[model samples]
Target: MIVPPPLRFGVLGLGRAGVSMLPALRTHPHAVVAAAADLNPTARAQFTRDFEVPAYDSAEALCASPEVGVVYIATPHQFHAEHCLLAAANGKHIVVEKPLALTLADCDTIIDAVERAGVTLIVGHTASYNPTVGAARAIIRTGELGRLRLINFAAYTPFLYRPRRPEELDSASGGGILFNQTPHQVDASRLLGGGMLKSVRATAGVWDPGRRTEGACAALLQFDDGAAASLVYSGYDHFDSLEFRVSTEDERSLSLTSHGATRRALNEGARSPDEETAMLSAMGYGGPAMRSVGPGGMGMFQVELGLAIVSCERGDLRLVADGLIIYDDEGRRSLPLRYDRGVPGRGNVFDELRSAVVDGIRPIHDARWGKATLEACLAIQQSSKEDREVYLSHQVTVGD
Candidate 1:
């Protein structure tokens, strides 16, 4: 009997995202969950028992396991840099959840380790793999929108009801809405921009001063091709206001937004029936406007995982090389654009993490691109804090 090689995976942090992704990882053709680690002993035990896999007390121990070929770092934003470095040092391919690292210096650390070890590192900005996002890219590529002029996107959340621990809310722990939630939008903007960032100008504020982290931020980005994007984000707002939108050179636009009773009432109260008066102020639409909206969490995960599996099997090299090309009639160049309806209650990221390992192809969330995104995040934070525009360097710096 011949024995098959298994791409054994070591998972660190069995949190919500990690737990959710386990199913997909297990389904992968060449991957198997061999070892796991988490700070939470109960979580570690539960995960290991559930999967019938070996469990380690720490990521270090899990990384040291010979059975593990890849390491999935699903820890909080603050720990991503350190986790990636440790995994790389152990010669394991890595898939880290987004934001890469909290700072440029941290990103440099992860980058250096990966390069020095010659290991693959992928950032888990799963939004980049969504089919709707893909569709948007495709549309832009077709020039149906007729030249990219301005892109406007927003992500809003009501943090009042979240279950995060006090430490998790610290800015240093990557607790801000910008650091914790902005990576998806950042990835979207970069994908749409299709070139390196030229400059970034941003203004953000923490509404409750007590929070000290950002409550709202609006950023302006200029890509090398003169394509511009205006990204707005808020963490202090109500849950009903989430939205994402894009506008084109031809005056057409696409929008997506969530709906709620308050939002609907606001819209209804905008006009006065008896006096034919504008009952609400233009700026008082409460916040940013959106076109389409619905529940979007779980569905996003499933799509993301599926793409990772596909990208891994086919090799991410081709996708990376061809990521930016979309042509139009008259032989003009254009970017890709896609629009998709949101789905609810689907399995996600963990699933893809598992499957990618099984396929023997490198995971979609590799180290190099992850390092780049982390570097971008760091640059954004620096620009925001220093009140000056920051530019992404052509050559990325990493730590070993």
Candidate 2:
């Protein structure tokens, strides 16, 4: 067998997402972390020390580096477009973290840049790579479910209570559950609903005095085929749905007893940054770690924290950690899946991205698709503010 040359990656952020992605990139057969860039001196130093890769202070410098062939943009929501443009200009294939951009216009800007540069653009929406999600998509494609009807996704997390930078608490700058969490649900819905978003109606809440952004959101999405989706999310740092389901890959269950003990510790007094990190780590919430590998292999990390159910005319599909559970007139069945490194169906996000870049095959979650997902997410906020259903036709351009 012939082995292809690895795609060299220059990571643009060393933040939480960036750090978590490192293990997957390292384990990927056709990818390598060549270098990294971050504004924080400490993060830069740590990345360089750990990965033994050169580090830069600016994204522009990293993108311009000859050693880097693919630029991974894990920067904040606001910087996504700018970083993507920078990487495109440098002639690098791009992989951007989710919520592709804070707004539709920004997403377009990145899209235009990538199209102009003639490079591949892949959005890193990890939930889309979940084995269960993949199995659901496969089952839907088989037409076993008949006509897709509704997608209901719900998540609850102690998001804000976790470590955060200041901008993470601001809504305008793209902080909050809407921008951070809803993108996963929306992207999954769009993928299974056949990718044409029609409209959205949503409501958001700011129940916490300490956090300025929306801590919770509920949205209704309408697809062009008459399919509808319901999305409910909360990040107030209280109840965790993943804990409730005991579906985390780490095998750590978040029972009420543990939740109350942790909550009591936090309520006792304000925690320093170190204390917070320690607490989060103890709860099995930290950087990525490898799970499974070959056929039936799992990725290094799992961030999904709730449940997603897709209701079809002939059956109902529920997403679980290992795979999916389906219910129909014949009763219930479970389909298990695994990650097979670089192979298409058996692989994870990195594999899909690798195929897109190396083989010139456009992934379903490419830049344009990511932009559509972003539009749906923004509409959720707009609908909540305007007190009306927001139509998506005007949000997406004709060419896109």
Candidate 3:
């Protein structure tokens, strides 16, 4: 068998998103890091040292790399669209991080740019990429569960208390759960509900006086097919929803070990943006050589971002750490999934991107799909502001 040369990937941003994917990109059969770009000199230098690839200080330099066939946009929320446009203009296919952009118009701009450039664009790294989510969606479509009725999804984390950039704690700058986290819930819910969010009623909580961005939200999403999802997310550090996760792995603890330190650091005092950026670079791809020597019974990648409980006419589906559990009149059973490794927990996203780039297949989670998810997220905020359910008009179905 003849194997094609790996698609050279240029990564823009050395912060959480870009750095987290580097390890996976290094190991993927069809992908490779050709270059990277970051505004932080520390990050660029670190990336160059670790990856042995040119790490540019500006997005333009990274995008201009002749070796790059694809560009992965992992910049801050506000920079997503700009970086995407740059990559598209450079004739590189794209795999941009979640929420696509800060606004629908920005998302549309990216869509138009990529369309004009004739390059594939995928906005992801979300729960929709979970194999268990895929399995659940397939099982629901089997008609054995009857009609889909309701979905209960919730996730709690120390997002608000984590070390953050200046834009991270400000709602006006797209720093909040509605932009960063809810995209996962909304997209996954849309996929499970068969897409098309008809309307939304929601309440977004912005309770932290120290950090003025939204810290929590509870949304009721109504799909076009009449399915509904009650989605809740809280970034406050006090309560952890993962504690309630059902898993195939050791079921003893669900604590985020780093949460305490990050929360303490946040509460200690204000931190300079440069200090935080340096800290972010240290945690990213090139900063420090890191290792974890833990007892290995279950795999490290066997985890989910949030929990979901789906209700149908005849049965229910509950997502677990390793796979899924079904409850029907016949009894209970589990379906554990095993997929190819990529991006830690997000194997499907990698697969989809590969197919788009190598086989010229359009991903179900393409630009329009990402826009639909963003539209729903925006509707949640709008609904909260107006104290009324906001209707949606731009939703599209999932899949080809």
Could you tell me every candidate's TM-score relative to the true structure? 0.67, 0.86, 0.92
Model 3 whole-model lDDT (C-alpha atoms):
0.80
Ranking under TM-score, best-scoring first? 3, 2, 1
Q: Pick the candidate with the highest TM-score.
A: 3
After superposing candidate 1 on the true structure, give the runs of residues whose Cα lies further than 4 Å from its correct spot. Answer: 1-6, 27-30, 142-146, 159-161, 242-297, 301-368, 394-400
* lDDT (C-alpha, whole model) for all candidates: 0.56, 0.75, 0.80
User: If both were scored by TM-score, which would come out higher, candidate 1 or candidate 3?
Assistant: 3
- Give all candidate RMSDs, comma-separated: 12.2, 4.4, 2.8
Q: Which has the greatest lDDT? A: 3
- Tens-place lDDT digits, model 2, residues 112-212: 99999999888884476666776777788899779889998888777666545567778888888888888888877777777788999999998878667
After the best TM-score superposition of candidate 1, give how far the Cα of residue 49 lies from its true spot, in angstroms. Answer: 2.2
What digit string (tens of lDDT, one per residue) describes model 3 on residues 1-400?
7877787888888777775677667767678889998887877876788788899988999899897888888888888999999999999989899989988999899999999999999987887777777888898899899999998887877778766777887878888889888888888889899888899999999987877889899999998888899999988876666665645344455445644555787556446666664554466654563222122222322222456788999999888766788999999998776655544344456678888888888788888898999999999999999999999998998763
Q: Which stretches in model 2 have alpha-carbon errors above 4 Å?
A: 247-254, 260-305, 342-347, 394-400
How far residue 102's Cα lies from its native spot in candidate 2, in Å, is: 1.5
Which model is ahead, 2 or 3, in terms of lDDT?
A: 3
